[model samples]
Target chain A: MSPVSFFKCLADDTRLHCVLLLQHKGELCVCDLVDAIGESQPKVSRHLAQLRECGILLTRREGQWMYYRLNPQLPAWAAAVIGQAAEGNSVYLKPALVRLGKSESQASCCD
Target chain B: MSPVSFFKCLADDTRLHCVLLLQHKGELCVCDLVDAIGESQPKVSRHLAQLRECGILLTRREGQWMYYRLNPQLPAWAAAVIGQAAEGNSVYLKPALVRLGKSESQASCCD
Candidate 1:
């Protein structure tokens, strides 16, 4: 991806949050992100669409659920940047992680 | 700065170029950037203003020249991200860097 596209993909906090969550979680479904971030499903989905379009994220379908993760094809530097952001912004990320933990502990529709 | 602000500041190619240039050079006057990036002086200045307003960059003036550099106050992750981008995107950055080298070799208005 072009460098500009890389930055543009992450320019929004919602998108940045989603990318960070995926970095920390490995993978997550739309429902998981919605729960973790406490935003409307539509809003989160829109951001996810932009991310996917920018090639920053990839998605897979399992049954009726879609799971999103960072695009494995990402350059090492881009991946490292996301990794650093996740590690360095733990305080900002804690709430989302907490919510994700709670959501995952319960069997969701993805199951 | 908010994570969103961090990304927002760099979402555009022009702004990203300016930020990466600062990351590579440490400090540069607006004219230096104009010379490096081959963009108009006013255009480069506009992007620099946006970067400065976003807190991603800091500026200082000496005599008739105003120099810009990455804001030292940036979080470790933010700085690392810029560093990684510069390293990984060297091919895309070479033209600008080449120009910077040539410009610095000559005594510019900044001198």
Candidate 2:
């Protein structure tokens, strides 16, 4: 993706948080993101749709659940940009990570 | 800056070009960007103002010209994002760089 398109995908709070959380967690479902980000499911799902449209994310289906992960085919630079943001901003991701951990321990949304 | 804020600064075409140009060139004046990107001076300046307001760019006064550059104190991650965008997308910047080179060879904006 062009830099503008790539950056646009990350310009919003929901999208950025979702992308970063996925980067950290490898993959997550919509319910997991809703639990972690504390946003309504529809809102989180809307942003995920946008990211998927932009090709920054890929979705997988297993039975009834859909999982999202950073697209493996993302250009190297795009992946690097995500990596830098994810690695460099732990404090920003901590609260969501905690929520995600709590939700996962309580029986993951996918489970 | 927060990743969302940082990415927002680069989400627009004008702002993204101005920023990536500034990143590639080290520093530039409004006129230089106008000449390079072929956008109206006011439009370019307005975006530069936003970048400055977002703390992604710093400006210095030089006689009748105001020069813009990436803020040196920008967090490492921010700088890395810019660097990755610049280094990985030479083709996106090529047309503007050509114009910038021609503009410089003829007479720089600050000169």
Candidate 3:
């Protein structure tokens, strides 16, 4: 993807959070992101669809659940940009991560 | 700046080109970007103002010219993102670079 397109995909709060969470967690379902980011399922799903359309993310289906992850085929530079953002901004993601942990401990999503 | 804000600053083609150009060139005047990107001067200056407001760029004034460059104090991750985009996407900026080179050789801008 072009740099503008890639950056545009991450310009929104929901989309950037979702991408960073996936960068950290390897893979997550739509429900997991909704819980982690405290956004409605539809909103999170919409942003995920945008990211997928931009080719920044890849999806997999297992039964009724869909999982998303950073596209492995992303150019090394693009991946590096995501990695740098994810690695350098842990505090920014802390609350979402806490919510994710609590949700995981309480009940698994997409089960 | 937050990743969302930072990415937002680069989400547009004009702004992204101006930024990537500055990242590669170290510093440039508004007229230089106008010539390099083939955009109207006001449009290039407007985007540069946005980037400066977002703290992604710093400006210096000399005589009648204002030069812009990536903010040196920018967080490492943000700088890395710019560097990676600038380096990995040379072809995207090729025409602009050629324009910049020709303009420089013909007559320096803001002279």
Q: Give stretches of model 3 more than 4 Å off.
A: none
What's the CA error at residue B51 for candidate 3, in Å? 0.8
TM-score for every candidate vs. truth? 0.92, 0.97, 0.97
In order, the candidates keep a fraction of the true contacts of 0.83, 0.73, 0.78
**Selected candidate, larger TM-score, 1 vs 3:** 3
Question: Can you write out model 1's per-residue Cα lDDT over B1-111, one digit (the tens) per residue?
Answer: 777778777778788889898888899899989888888888989989998988889999998899999999988888888898889999988899998998888987587
Alpha-carbon interface RMSD of model 3? Answer: 0.8
Lowest lDDT 10-mer window, candidate 2 chain A? A102-111
Task: Give the residue spans of candidate 1 off by over 4 A.
Answer: none
lDDT of 3: 0.92
Residues A32-86 of candidate 1 have per-residue lDDT tens digits of: 9998999999999999999999888999999889999999998899888888878
State the DockQ, from 0 to 1, for candidate 2: 0.83
Question: For candidate 2, lDDT tens digit of each residue in A9-99?
Answer: 9999999999999999898989999999999999999999999998999999989999999999998888999999998899999999999
Candidate 2: stretches off by over 4 Å: none
Order of candidate numbers by DockQ, starting with the best: 3, 2, 1
**Comparing candidate 2 with candidate 3, which one achieves the higher lDDT?**
3
